[model samples]
Target: MAGMVEQVGPPGRDDITAYAAERTGGASVRVGALAPLTRPGWVQAGRHLLAGMELAVSEVNDGGGIAGRPLELVVRDTAADPRRAGAAVEELAGLGVAALAGEYHSVVARAAARAHALGLPFLCSSAVLDALTEEPTDRVARLSPPQSHGWQVYADFLLRAGHERIALATEPSVYWASGAGILREYVAPRGGTVIELDARALTPAGLCDELAGHRASALLLLAGHPEPAVSIVRSVRRDPRLAEVTIGAPAGQPEFAEWATLLGDEGTAIPFLRYLPERLSPLGARVEAALRARLAHPPSFVAFEGYDTIAVLADALRAGGAGRTRPAADWSRVTVEGTRGRIRFSRTPGISVWQWTGAPVQVVDRDPSEPGRFRVLHGG
Candidate 1:
């Protein structure tokens, strides 16, 4: 498979005629994938995600597929809209998909509550809202760390970096709010003070002026989207008063390269928590090479996540057999090796549902001179 990583072509089709002797006969297992494919906010990332999913599906089919059955992905554009996401779930369910995956927005993932209600297994690829997996559901599992866990990683990094007073610049969304709340919860009890600011209401110059009045060591941008976070970063770079203050954002993970491109030299040294580190494992190197061969640029963390989601689903289908609902116990026992590390899901103490808690979160920074180089500061 190492030599085949760079092979670019259409995925192989399962030959049902050649598999007539198989016990159950050959068939394609359809998996539903919901992503904001055409939405302006997430289209680029969504495309990379789709590519990753396709790569996994291709690899699976190449290896003779699950029990001689091919895996087919039926993707739909949710547009990051909750109503549209709900409709997509119903449509995929109507199509009789064996499983579901790929949701980028927390709001859209929440709207996919129909998957839980319908007893369809949904492996969430990237949505990080804490509430998405806060309640137990036999049919739902999230591969990404929750927003609270990511914030906890960032908060710990800040504390370790000697930041005592933190300023939170947040967008007006449930995702951002949940992240901010988690950051405060983690920081406050540890003798750190957090001051909140409205990221959406403030202009670049206005944010600089507001930050000048506060005596904070660092500013944590909790905006889930790139616009406000990019605005905040540009403002901080332009203002001399904020020169010494470290600017960071957990939401910057998916769009780090794009933000770095836009910010140029100003983007350097801005710490952010990313699920995958700058350094790739041997498996990650192969995945990266494969992605670079197919994509215009290198794949993002979400792309790797998309690949992992489908890979896990393939494992579930194999372990539980096709067209059958596996008990949550059986699903919990299934694990696969991912690009980052070992992938597994478990119900944590605070979080009520099963989720992949072992996110290889690392605080990374863009290099000042190297165009695409990133330095891993801590963790992972």
Candidate 2:
């Protein structure tokens, strides 16, 4: 999909006779796409992610269907469970999907990547964990920037904002721990200090007490959504002693529309990291409009990540990764003009998976005056 998704309307279908096969009474090149579709998972993010993948698949199929065979997406709901995700990866592989793509949670993606040790290529979509796998392999590639990369950007934003003494309210999760560690490492030498607060041990009120006692000007939420994160925000906002504190969620929790629906105007101005450029490319604009129609709301960067995942996979199939062992995660040959920018994979020193080095990273938040609008605070 070199100049990928140039036109974003209904994908035009080609010859149907070429689509005959044993399964579904038709021939389709299948890619198993995973997302957290049910509860305990971020459903809004999943919905947007799926929407983008679906749209891209439709376009790919319409655009002549990978050597005239229809492109198919076999989607499974991970539900934020690592074990379930591992199982899903096995099932998808058994069903003979040419490759695997899409997973939002880092922990769950790690599980799927582990199960994927069986040798199927996996193109990871939203997960940003630096160590996606316990060890590196040639069979996997990633779309989102790693935790270390994005967190460094967020840390830089914090330093520029003069929030040297920061408080990170965190849960006991690998993803959260990695993020907290990244912020601490990146901010410390620059004269910033990170204070860790155990969100699990601290009630919202107690967390507020800690924030006040520590006198931290900035508090970054590194915990799960709606529970501790939302609760902590509510408590901090209500506490008079913490009125001057700047609350942040660099984990991109505030990117989804549901965040706004849940926290309303209060969610505005709480900066979070998002993977979008300051301005959309022509292809991005078209995809963004199409995504809005499908999602019935503005699509988050996760949705664009999903769309770009398909665009790259489709291009890879065209480049011959559809054969049994040569799957779409082949980073060397892929050069997709994605919705955000040109997608190309390379090895950075610390990142384990084949990573797209050019995905744009930004720190943005909903405008306080107009909660529906997003304002970019920093970009890197």
Taking all chains together, each candidate's TM-score versus the true structure is 0.88, 0.93
Residue range 181-239, candidate 2, lDDT tens digits: 89999998999999999999999999999989999999999999877788888889889
**Prediction 2 global C-alpha lDDT:** 0.85
Native-structure RMSD, model 1? 4.5
Top candidate when judged by TM-score against the true structure = 2
Which portions of model 2 show Cα errors greater than 4 Å? 1-26, 325-329
What is residue 110's positional error in candidate 2, in angstroms?
A: 1.0
TM-score of 1: 0.88
Model 2 / residue 319 / CA error / Å: 1.2
Residue-wise C-alpha lDDT for candidate 1, range 213-287, written one tens digit per residue: 987879877774457677678889888888789887667543446676677777777787778955678888898
Error of 2 at 356 (Å): 0.4
* lDDT by candidate, in order shown: 0.75, 0.85
